[model samples]
Target chain A: MSNIFPEVANKVPRWILFGLTLKVLAIIAGLYYYFTPSYTRAGYQPVQPVSFDHSLHVKQVGLDCRYCHTFVDRSEHSTVPSSNTCMNCHSVVKADSDKLALVRESYQTGESIEWVKIHDTPDYVYFNHAVHVNRGVSCVHCHGQVDEMEEVYHAKSFTMNFCLDCHRNPEEFIRPVDKVYDLQWEPEDPEWEEQAQAFVHDWKVMPPESCSGCHR
Target chain B: MNRIITVVYIFLIILVVSVLGFRGSKSRKEPLYLFPDMDRQARYEPQGENPFFEDKMDDRLPPQNTIARGNALDRAGVFSSGFDATELTDVAFNTGRDEAGEFLKELPIEVNHELMELGRERYDIFCAVCHDETGDGNGAVKNFAPPTLSSANLLTQLYIDQSEGEIYNTISYGKNTMMGYADKLSPKERWAVVLYVRALQRAANATADDIPEAKRGELGL
Candidate 1:
């Protein structure tokens, strides 16, 4: 301790040392929030290539999400539709539009629309499209009432606890596959629906809820 | 110079003591391990309170480390799931049949004309590559040829020696050279393909006389 400074020989008062330590900590606290990223909405919402509307396709056109995003029930990704999927109607249906031009160019060049992904789990979270889809999760459960959205927002704040709550008690939040994807869907009668949801949700599926559930 | 020497001596002493202590701990100087009676090894420290609520382990741990006992360890939970072969068999046999068992009663399955069309598409992708489009055994696999899954011989044997669920079980988990559809087909698709397979078998056996003329092309004689 004496080696640190010549002043170390002096008997520093405990109060003076504690007060200086607190002042240093306060300055550090002031700088901390300044550097931290904004915690609102998972801190990432990069712009997508095209302004796509979920409500127009899902609610109005009555297109099931699985139509365009074909592999959701069978694979890892609820894959972005290929340009051809868009062009299936776009090429002939909207022949004059810029969206059609972009589609035509992608069809010719074989590059896809550069869509920035909005929904993302952390790298550690191991989610499967198959388990959720086949086991009665509707697409709307995580994706929100995407069919009703004008511009898709982060459907809900999909946090670890948010997912585990349903996973732990699957039937409560689980419903017919048709209604799974709705964020805005409240059960018609809160008490009756809550009881019904509880019946299935109470099945007590013991999911791996620790670090490895998502991490590995 | 003296201070530096003193500091270095203290560091060396710490390094030596730590190494010796680690080695001593590893050696287990108590030789009573061979005789369980002479040892305190049998004494069970409570494996800690609330074992269930604690974080689970890799599941690959040895018997000693495993907390699982009795009901929890009976079978892989996957086996109990609707997707598993055994569970699927039970559901297949119980549901989807009426009195005479002529055809499916009402299985809790969703039907999309698009998805069945998708079933037709994926059946072409996966099933046809083996079962052949005509439901015959002449698929284009280089050397291996699987049995005709669409044959009346296999399909018509109601209770088929093996239960219907057992057949579904076989399709899912696979048998002989057939790869299990567990990886390839979703549970719904697997069930759909089973229905589609039945349709193919019925078609394979159906003659022109059996069809009501109007729906013949759709049956594709």
Candidate 2:
């Protein structure tokens, strides 16, 4: 038979096969990196109606986390403070400032401020702020160094794996109950591991690893 | 052919990097959902938005004049009148006042070390920001506030002369330009704060003679 195929035909088939393999590999790599909560959820900084500065309130003013999040240790959900809580200080301190105009209006109108929420978990996952906080989990563990942030952002991935990592070994994360609100707190003792283990034992912090524990 | 393949690979890499960017990069855009699958249910969450309501709020305020359940007077033993429990006219524990609408001279709840400790914690969290740790009205907030809005000096003679219930009322309903903490502090917590405030007043006014004989040596009084 005459040379039915062109001289480049052999190279063309090989190149096409190589390109298909590379395409598949690229897709796998893309999904592996981009599908995670780390890429999708973390570092989400939303613009709030009023530019509330956490560093100013927490670092300078020296207010406790519970001062505004009063129900953190008492209720399932840690509530955002009402406009009245802002007016508590602003009414006297910066009463006429333009920055507090929205707060003043919300207080007078008895309307809820449209503050954007961060760190939202999936609907199926049931997370309780009081349960974790009461068990010596510091706010900084999940929320990061909010006392230093000028604008709050989602600091942690909050993936199921992230939660499970703590649940599996809570002794690695637990601190003194009194120091839960003290975000700057660190173990002064060199033998901090022993102290954490002791807390896990004494407090009976048996985090459920079963699916029903969280999904229910 | 080899050169063409190499160039295509490089282009593909640049495309991916430009589109996805780096992980955890700061972004103002909302998190993109690849597999939303029941991630956000239709059910209402606490403080969630609802288009159905005029206020666009899922959390509705309780109807007017409706007190939440489970707020009954359980700790009125300290100031219990001779009257029977059923016949008790005024719940002093909740109101911080007697049936005659007068502030109670003393706390209606029994004071103890536990309650005092709770008072210290709650006071530091809610009151010390403005009232100062020593009740001197010089707190972190005082540095920012005008002289007219300065927190009250709880150790002053004016405050010392006030009754416990009056102090409780102030903590609950607030006084002057101060906003009420009734929402933040429960009735028992308000009383605990009152006890702590009284202790602060006593400590501020104490003399060398007031120190206990055993503790005096510790302070070298």
Q: For residues B1-221, could you state the per-residue lDDT of candidate 2 as single tens digits?
A: 68887898889899989987988788899998988999999998988899999998888887787744533455364345664443233479878889899999998887899889889999999999999999998989999998766789999999999999999898899889888999999888888999999999999999989897989999988
TM-score of each: 0.42, 0.91
Query: What is the lDDT for A76 in model 2?
Result: 79
lDDT of 1 by residue, A121-202 (tens): 5444578887677666677677666677666555454656678778676766666554544445566765756665554556
Model 2, range A1-216, lDDT digits (tens) per residue?
Answer: 889999989788788888899889988988888898988999899998999999899988999999999999999789999999988888898889998899999999987889988889999999999999999999999999999999999898888899999999999999999999999998999999998998899999999999999999
In terms of lDDT, the poorest run of 10 residues in model 1 chain B is B23-32
How would you encode candidate 1's per-residue C-alpha lDDT over B191-217 as one tens digit per residue?
A: 666656656667777779878889878
Ten residues in sequence with the least summed lDDT for candidate 2 chain B: B81-90
By TM-score, how accurate is candidate 1?
A: 0.42
Q: Rate the local accuracy (lDDT) of all candidates.
A: 0.53, 0.89
Name model 2 segments beyond 4 Å from true.
A1-18, B64-90, B208-212
Every candidate's fraction of true contacts kept comes to: 0.00, 0.83
- lDDT at residue B16 of model 2 (Cα atoms): 84
